[model samples]
Target: MKTKLNVGCGTDIKPDYINLDVADLPGVDVAHDLTKFPWPFADNSFDTIELINVLEHLPDTIATLEELHRIARPDAKVMVRVPYWNSPDMLADPTHLRSFSERTLNFFDPAFPECKDRPYYSTARFNIMRKSCYIRFFYYLKINARFLTTPLFFLARYLGAVVWVIEFDLRAAKSDNK
Candidate 1:
């Protein structure tokens, strides 16, 4: 039986997933503070993990990712969704600790050029299989007005939103080299 985790799941819970949260909420299967180190589960305990609108709130994202990498099996698929850096969703929320961009995850992949110079920043590595950006519906008209005149149009069309969110499907690159 494969383990599926919904980390930081609040009111939302799926049937089979272990709904983990800091609060002892109604649907939570495991109530533990994610900010704490060495989560209860053993290493390589999970095959799939989802972080839906949860990463930005973490105080230490890199540490959290490292912990996730510690728990996930090699080639495990990890899904992450975060508000785009330029989006109002990222700014309006006082609890939001960080913003993300297309290149944010690239820092985790040592194969990426950005990490080539400073590989020691993170020992964990993941291969980003897919990423998508969504645009804010209300800002469509305003953004469209500048479509051909500025780069924002091209960025908006391909990247997504005045209140954009980005989703990434990452495969943990765990190996004996670690």
Candidate 2:
């Protein structure tokens, strides 16, 4: 069977996924705080990971990403959804520990100029195969509720919601030791 993990999966549980969260819930496969190291899963065990509205809540983004890298299969695809820094949703959440901008995830992009000297840089160590965004549907509908039933809604999704999706891949670094 394909192994899929939903990290920080609060109430939204995907049927096929191993729903993980710090809190106790009915279908939770794992209930451990993310702040600690060494997640329950074995190294390179998961094919896909979903972090929906979760990254900003982690106290240490670098450590969290490192753990994510440790658990994922060599060429895993990770989907992350976070509120844009400027959006009200970002600030409204009292538990949100970090704010994200366009460059937030790019820190993992190898081509980024400052990857060499930065201590927190991980993209240089992992290959980023993809990156994209999507605007929240509710946000679009709020801006133009009148256009809700029109094709413009679809156009907005195709054209305007580019900053939202934030999808990417992280390839494990080739080790010289091997």
Candidate 3:
């Protein structure tokens, strides 16, 4: 049987996914703190993992990624969604502990040698498979009106708040070197 795990599901639960969260909410299959290791599920159990608005909440990003890697089957596909560092929504949340840039997810790429290194070096390890930026017009308007007398549409493209989704394929490290 195929399995899908959704971390930090909050109140949104998909029929096909095993909804998990630290809080006890409706449709939550497991209510456990994510910071703890060895999540309730078995090792190499999930074929797909979804982390939406969850990574930024964890204090230990590397440990959290390792736990996700432990539970995911080899070649499993993982999807992550997070607000851009410049986004107001990202800063408004008190629980958000980390800010993400375009290269945030690249650290998880198994091909990168830095993956074997400590969590602090994660950003230097992974490669980006795909990325998209979402910009809010309201934020752009505010910035243009306050900071610039003229409409700086170009500036908004670069400085506007963004929402990003990144995908990665997790694979076992090559054994030839070891």
Candidate 4:
């Protein structure tokens, strides 16, 4: 059976997923602190995992990503959503420890320039598959969200605050160690 994990799934539980959160909510299947290292699951335990609007709340982004990578099966797909770096929504919540942009996840991509030299930065490797952006004021208008992250990703470099949230689909790289 394929195992799927919904990390930081507060109250939104999916019957198909093992819901996890720090709070002992009714839907949480595993109420464990996310900040702590070595999640309860064994290595390469999950084939699919998601962190919807959860990355920003964690204190250590890289560490959490690494742990997620450790528990994921080879080439497992991981989805993450976080408040856009320039958006006020990131600062609106006191629990938000950090904000992210279209390029923020690139730090975990071993092929990305930022991580090429810093081998010690993070051991986790992910190949970014797709990225999308959400604009709050224009929520009703579905103005080509893909462009915000494609060749026109440069737009965020200048007018990033306009973006409310950024979502990424990543495929975990195969690891020999695992």
lDDT of each: 0.80, 0.67, 0.64, 0.84
Q: Candidate 4 lDDT, tens digit per residue, 120-142?
A: 88888899888888765555553
lDDT assessment of candidate 3: 0.64
Q: What clash pairs does model 2 have?
A: 108-123, 132-166, 133-164, 133-165, 133-166, 134-164, 134-165
Among these predicted structures, which one has the highest TM-score?
Answer: 4
Which order, best to worst by lDDT?
Answer: 4, 1, 2, 3
Model 3 lDDT per residue over 1-178, tens place: 5499999999989779999999999999889999998799887788788888788899987788777767776656677767667668777899889977655555666544444454465432223344544444655432212223113323434764433322233342222221
- Which tens-of-lDDT digit does each residue in 139-159 have in candidate 1? 554222222323443475464
Query: Once superposed on the true structure, which residue ranges of model 4 sit more than 4 Å away at CA?
Result: 138-144, 151-153
Model 4 lDDT at residue 142: 36
Quote the lDDT for 36 in model 4: 91
RMSD of candidate 3 to the true fold?
7.0
Q: Order the candidates by TM-score, highest first — what do you get?
A: 4, 1, 2, 3
Better of 1 and 3 by lDDT: 1
Q: Candidate 2 lDDT (Cα, whole model)?
A: 0.67
Tell me which of candidates 1 and 2 scores higher on lDDT.
Answer: 1
Candidate 2 per-residue lDDT over residues 1-178, each given as its tens digit: 5489999998898899999999989888889998988888887777788888889899988888888877777666676666656556666789989977645655665666545447465532566665444445556543312323234324533554424333444565534331
Error of 4 at 116 (Å): 0.8
Residue pairs in clash, model 1: 135-161, 136-161
Model 4, poorest ten-residue lDDT window? Answer: 135-144
TM accuracy, model 4: 0.90
C-alpha lDDT of candidate 1 relative to the true structure: 0.80
